[model samples]
Target: MFFSQLINLKEDDSSMQFIIITHDAEIFDDSSVENIYKFESAPDGTIVSRL
Candidate 1:
């Protein structure tokens, strides 16, 4: 509910931007998301991926 509200608020206000960090990808199932960054941990360090 809160998550959806955030999206709605962002849509209503063009100047608004939300930064969400979530483990579930279902929230990003919509076409509204322009960019997605995934993080993975390795033995050496952390790796970042753009999907």
Candidate 2:
């Protein structure tokens, strides 16, 4: 999953942070992130998913 926010440069002096939760540890393999979460899943290919 991905999370992002828009901030006004004229109002905020610091950058925004986001939180993400995922069942796979490999999701961050070739990506950079601010945070991460991991969990196990069933092998049937469909065990509850979200966009």
lDDT of 1 by residue, 1-51 (tens): 665676675635555556778898788886477788898999999998998
Cα deviation at 33, candidate 1, in Å, is 1.0
Clashing pairs in 2: none
C-alpha RMSD for every candidate: 3.3, 8.0
Error of 1 at 4 (Å): 7.5
Q: lDDT by residue for model 2 over 2-27, one digit each (tens)?
A: 33324443365876765555456686
Highest lDDT model number: 1
Clashes of each: 0, 0
TM-score of 2: 0.34
